[model samples]
Target: MIMVTGASGALGSLIAAKLAASGREVVAGTRRPTGSARRVDFDAPDSLAEAFGGVDVLVAVSAGFAEDDVVIARHRAVVEAAANAGVRQVVYTSLTGAGEHMSIAPAHRATERLLAAAPFAVTVLRNGLYAELLSQAAEQAVATGVLTLPLGGGKVAAAAREDLAEAAARVAVEADAQVDNAHRGRVYELVGSEALGGEDLASALSAEHGKEIAYAPLSLGDFRAALTAAGLPPFQVAHTVSVFANVNAGFMGGTESDLPGLLAGAPRRAIDVL
Candidate 1:
C-alpha cells in the first residue's frame, strides 16, 4: 500500500487523487481522519506508527511553516515513525537546490539528513517555488499597475504546483511497484524550464489586463519594514526577507531540471499561468 502524508494539503491532495485514479491502493494520511483516511499528525509522533503501518511506500510532504526548530522536530518525528513502521521507500518533497540560501532551506536539509539515516530507500523531489505563488505578484500588479518586490534582477524558476504534485505521485507509484529502484536514493531538481523575473511578471500582467504595468524594485530593508508594519510574526518576517535576499542575490534560478523527464509532457508555461 502507498500512503501520502499531509494528504489534505494542496500538494498532497493532488498526489493522492492521481495515485488513486491510477488504480493503486492509496491511503490518505491527514490530521483529521475521515472515511479510510488515517490520522497522521506530525506533531503527534505517537500516532504516526499506526498511521504508516502496512504502507510500503510513503510520500512525506514537507511540513511546518513555523520556526526552524519546530519544522525540524516535526520532520524528525515522521522519519522515526516511518523507520519503525517498516516502510520500504519514502518520497520527500523538499526545497529546490537553487533555494539553498533561503531561510526555509535549513529545515528541508535537516529532513533530508534524517531520511538518509533511516533504513528505507528514499527519493528527494527538490521542488521549485510554485508558479501559483508568483501569480500573486501579478494579481497585485494588475490592481496597482506596478509590480514591486525585492527581487532586483533575479528570476525564480517557478513550476506549477500541479506539475510538482504529479511528479511526486509518479515517483511514489514507481517505488510502490518496485520498478528497479531507479528513483531510490536519488535527488531530482524539479525546477521550471523558464525563469521569471519582476519585469517578466509585469509583462505578463500587462498582456493579461491590456494595460501598462511597470516593475518597481523595493529594497530588502523596505520590504521587511512593510511586512512588519503589516503585523507579521517575527519568524514569518525573517523567512520572507530571507527569500527575497536570496532571490536578489541571484540564487533562486537554474538552467537544468529533472521536472520534465518525470512528467508525462512539457511543463506548463509559468507566464501563461500568471
Candidate 2:
C-alpha cells in the first residue's frame, strides 16, 4: 500500500491520482483523513499505530513557506512517522538544490539525514524548477505583447511539474530501491534538455504567440521600481526582485542528469506546459 502525504496539493494530488489509476492500493493522506481507506493525519508520537496501520510505502510532499527551520521540523516529523510505521520504501519530492549550496537546500538536506538513519529504503527525487510557473508571465506577454522579468539571460533547465510527479510515483513503485539508493545519499541535478534564459524565454513566448514580444533586461533596482509601480507590497516586491536576481545569477536552475529519463520519456515542452 502506498501512502501519500500532502495529498491535496497540486503535485501530491497528481501523484495519488496516478497511483490510484495504476491500481496501486493508494492511501490518500491529508490533514483531515475521512472515509478514505488508509488515510492518515498529523499525529503525536504515541499515535503511530493509528496513523500508519497498513502502509507499505511512503511518499512525502511538502508545501509551505520556504523557511528552513519550519521545513526541517515538518520533514523530521514525516521521517519519524515513516520510520515508526516501518514503511518499506520512502520517497521524497525535494527541491532541485536540496543537497547543494542553494538557500532552499537546508531543510531537504536535514530531512535526508533523518531518513538515512532509518530502517526503510529511501529515495529522494531532487526535482527541477517548474515551467508551469511561467504561465502568468506568459499570459502577460501574450496580453501586453512584451516579455519582461528581472532574469537577465541566465539559463535555467526548467522541467514540467508532471515530469517531477511521474518520477516521484516511479520512485515509490520501482522494485529495486538500490537503483535510487545512491539517489538517497546523493542529489540529482535534475533539468530539462533545453536550458532557457530570460531572453530566450521571451523569444519562445513570441514564437508561440506570433507576437513581436521581446526580452526586457532591466536593472534589479528598475525591476523593483516596476513591481512597486504595479502596486505590489514592498516586502513581496523585494522578495520577487531578489528571486529574479538569484535566477539571473544562476541559483534556481542546474543541469546534468536528465530528469525526463527518470520518467522514461522527454519532459513536456515549455509551451505545452504553458
Candidate 3:
C-alpha cells in the first residue's frame, strides 16, 4: 500500500488521486479526509500509526506553516511512525535548495537529515517553487498593469503544481514496482526548464492577458510597506519579505534541470499557468 500524507492539500490531493487512478493501492492521509481516506495528524501519534499501518511506501509531504521547531517535531513524529509501521520506501516532498540558508529551508533540511537516519530507503523530491503561488500577484498585475515585487533582477525556477504532483505519483508507483531501494538517499531537483525573471513573467502575463504589463522592482522596505498597506499581518509580512530576499539572492533560479524529463516532455511555461 502507498500512503500519501497531507492528502487534503493541493499537491498531496493531486498525488493521491493520480496514484489511485494509476491502479496503485493508495491511502490518503489527512486531518479530515473524506470517502475512503484516513485521518492522520502529525500531532497525533496514534493517528500516524493507524494511517501508516500496512503501508509499504510512504510519501510524506511537508507540514503546513508552523514554527521551525514545531515543524521539525511534527515531522519527527511522522518519521518515527513510518519506522514503526515497517514502511520500506519513503518519498519526501521538499523545497528546492532547501539545504541552503533560505527562509523555509531549516525545517525541510532538518526533516531530510532525520530521514537520512531512518532504517528505510528515502527519495527526496526537491521541488521548485509553484507557479500558482504567483497567481495572486499576477491577478493584481493584470488589474493594475504593473508587476511590482521585491524580486529585483533575480530569476525563479518554478513549475506547475499539477506537474510536481504527477512526478511524485510516478516516483511512488515506480518505487513500489522496484522495491529494490535503488533510489535510496537520492535527491532530484524538479524544476522548470527556463529560469524566469520579473520581466519574463510580465511578458508571459501580457501575452496571456493580451495587455501591456510592466515589471516594477521595489526596494525591500517599499515591498514590506506595500504588503502591510495591503492588510497583511506582521508575521505574514515578515515571511513574505524573507521569501523575496531569497528570490533576490537567486535561491529559486536554476539554469538546467531534469524537470522536462521528469514530466516526460517539456514542462508548461508561465503563460500556460496564467
Q: Rank the candidates by lDDT, best first.
A: 1, 3, 2
Instruction: Look at candidate 3 and give me any clashing residue pairs.
Output: none
Each candidate's lDDT (Cα)? 0.90, 0.70, 0.84
TM-score of 2: 0.83
Model 2, which residues run further than 4 Å from truth? 33-49, 175-187, 218-243
Model 2 C-alpha lDDT per residue in residues 60-108, reported as the tens digit of each score: 8874444566677667777777777777777777766622555555666
- Per-prediction TM-score: 0.96, 0.83, 0.92
Candidate number with the higher lDDT (1 or 3): 1
User: Highest lDDT among the candidates is held by which one?
Assistant: 1
Select the stronger candidate by TM-score from 1 and 2.
1
Span of 10 residues, lowest total lDDT, candidate 1: 130-139
RMSD of 1: 1.3
RMSD values for the candidates in order, in angstroms, are 1.3, 3.6, 2.0
